[model samples]
Target chain A: MENTTSNQTAQNDLQVLRTSSLTGALERELEHLILTGELKPGERLNEIQLSSRFGTSRGPLREATRSLQAKGLVDAIRNRGVFVRSISPKEALEIYDIRAALFGLAGRLLTDMVTDAMLARLNEFLDEMDEIAQQRDFDRYYPVNLQFHDFLIRSTNSSMLAQEYKSLVNRLHLCRARGLVQAGGLAVSNHEHREMVDALASGNRERAQEAFFRHVERSKQRFTTTLEK
Target chain B: MENTTSNQTAQNDLQVLRTSSLTGALERELEHLILTGELKPGERLNEIQLSSRFGTSRGPLREATRSLQAKGLVDAIRNRGVFVRSISPKEALEIYDIRAALFGLAGRLLTDMVTDAMLARLNEFLDEMDEIAQQRDFDRYYPVNLQFHDFLIRSTNSSMLAQEYKSLVNRLHLCRARGLVQAGGLAVSNHEHREMVDALASGNRERAQEAFFRHVERSKQRFTTTLEK
Candidate 1:
């Protein structure tokens, strides 16, 4: 009897673990759909269809959807259904403003905290980004640029800031799936990236913050102008 | 046949509306419990008990808890249960820094946009807050101060900013249930509020931003000092 109870408890633990991991995987897959535009903005999610497509039951699927909804990727409407959020142009611009503030905060935080190792990593990314920008290889430069900014925020060692920053960036990605990688935009953006690194290396907190803030503001302008055209 | 179909549709709509509204009420009630510290940080939520206590079914109760979990009020464990999130002091201070940045952004946004009516409303808040501070009426001052900040952020005409600001404020509230308000803290804080309004009225965007940012930083310092004591 004791053995049976212990085995049952172990099985229960495994089931719980499996459920949680499945939910996480499901959430990521759905996020990929929304972020990559496979599921377009304002497209209603069909629960039954998605359940069969993912080969999962409704319980885990709902959990995943709820998590995404919380992250601002999906909107749940009463009696209606969950739909991919369609961010307005105004909201997109507002998001940029908030992102600029976050970047500014990260820059300021990094001013007195960037170690030699951290500086070297940032320099490496700057060089990588510069090369890709010169070649106009957006596919490679985009992730590198993201990495640079991510490194800036993460180095602050503030989990809340990093979490909020990631969520904001994800929503912004939903704003422009392919991103604002125009013909000459990549080169100009990387140049600003260089300025940010230079400002940080100069050990001037205010200048670093301003550089990071302005970098995002310029990108916002570029995106807005492109979106209008 | 048409009458029957239309009646059925109406009933379905009513059911949906009731469910949604009930879930919303439940959410607010749960929020009240958490915010008031009745739920206590890190306390595991009992869904079965909560459902019965709220006089609702498991379905709507789950919906309510899920929403709160998304808002960062509650944390959902994989299999154990959801618990009230206990924020660390470090996390609280980091929250303050982000809040400062957000307030700074709101101040800058307000610089070129403050209307006479808006200025009048802000002035009313300032005067009311000053009076409450003098009277040492914290109960009255707390909500007034919150409204003042809410008005400040909302006046920027950015819903995304407003939403994120509110979320940050809520998490900050979770940091301290009784707040950082002390005997003389109210009066000193209101003076800073006056400076923010003056800066806004001056229409110098940079100064306004600085004033707002510093105001939050000062509050952070006060809160940390109080929390330590």
Candidate 2:
């Protein structure tokens, strides 16, 4: 009887781990859908439909939705269901300002630590972005741009800063305003990226910081102008 | 027959609500204990003792512990149970960098929007810190110092930035290093506060941002110096 009880306990633990991992997988899948605009903002998360679509039970699905709600990627209403969070214009601008500070800090920290390999990686990003900009491909340019900034942030070796930056950027995706995507500003944005890369190469902290600061400021200006129009 | 079924459903809903609220309350209590250092870093949370101490059942207590783990306040091991998270020297310094960025952004944004009432509130914080510093009271000085920065962040009216800033500062509380607390540097810290307020009053964005950035840099320097010793 004692041996049987121990075996039961071990099985229960295994079941718990399996459920938790399932929940995590669902959460990531949902986050991808929501962030990429596939799920769209303010759309209610229908448990029945989602579970059927994913071929999973309701238990792990509900857990994943709860996790997204905790991350501020979704909103749960009393007696209602969870929905993808929608960011207001003002909130988006506020988030952009916070991102600017973080990006500037990344550039400043990178000034002292920028090695040959880091510069080579940044050069490759700029080249990829340049080709994309020439084609005026927003879809391709956008991801590369994200990757470029992500590389700089991760290179700073500050995990806390990188995590905070990523979280803000992820939430910014909920702002479905087409005007704020810097659509036609590709060449200009790439120009600014070049300036930032040049400053980083110069090993001047203030210059690198200002270049990054100005890039985000220009993007914010474009966003505001589009909103006004 | 329908009324009897509806009554049973109502009873179930009430039970669920009661359990949820109990979990939320327990989570807040646990957060308070952990953040205030009452629980201490790396100490395992004793579920039975905590539930008994709070007059709660183990069910809600376990739920609350899971919530805290999600919030990065605690770490749950496979078999050893959950323990309050400990911030390492490296992690603490990285968090400080992020907080500095958020704080500098707050100061820069406040430059354009500073009002007379905001100035009055800031003056109150400076005065409180000044008095505490003169008495060499680190215990009294610390909370006031936190409030001083918190007020500035809130006054900027950026909710996202304020939230990010608060989270970083809260995690820093997990670092139990005595050398990093700026115990004897209270007077110098207050002096920097005066400079920041002065810059904010002048309505120069660069000056305000620089003042805030440099103040944090000074504190980080103190931390590093102490760590080296």
TM per candidate comes to 0.88, 0.85
lDDT for position B187 in model 2: 89
Error of 1 at A126 (Å): 1.9
Candidate lDDT scores, in order, read 0.83, 0.83
Off by over 4 Å in 1: A1-21, A176-183, B1-22, B176-183
lDDT score of residue B216 within candidate 2: 89
- Across residues A148-170, which tens digit of lDDT does each residue of candidate 1 receive? 88878889998989999888878
Candidate 2 residue A87 C-alpha distance from true site, Å:
1.2
lDDT of 1 at A216: 88
Q: Model 2: per-residue lDDT, tens digit, A115-136?
A: 9988998999999899999999
Give one digit per residue, the lDDT tens place, for model 1 in B107-190: 988999998998898899989998889888988998888888888998899998898988887787676433554445898989
DockQ of every predicted complex: 0.43, 0.32
State residue A205's C-alpha deviation in candidate 2, in Å.
1.7
Q: lDDT per residue, candidate 2, B1-229, as tens digits? A: 9999999998985886654566666778899999878999999999899999988778767657766765577877755678999989899888877777777888899999999998998999999888888898898888788777777888888888877877777788888773435875988999999999999999998789878988988887788778777
TM-score of chain A of 2: 0.83
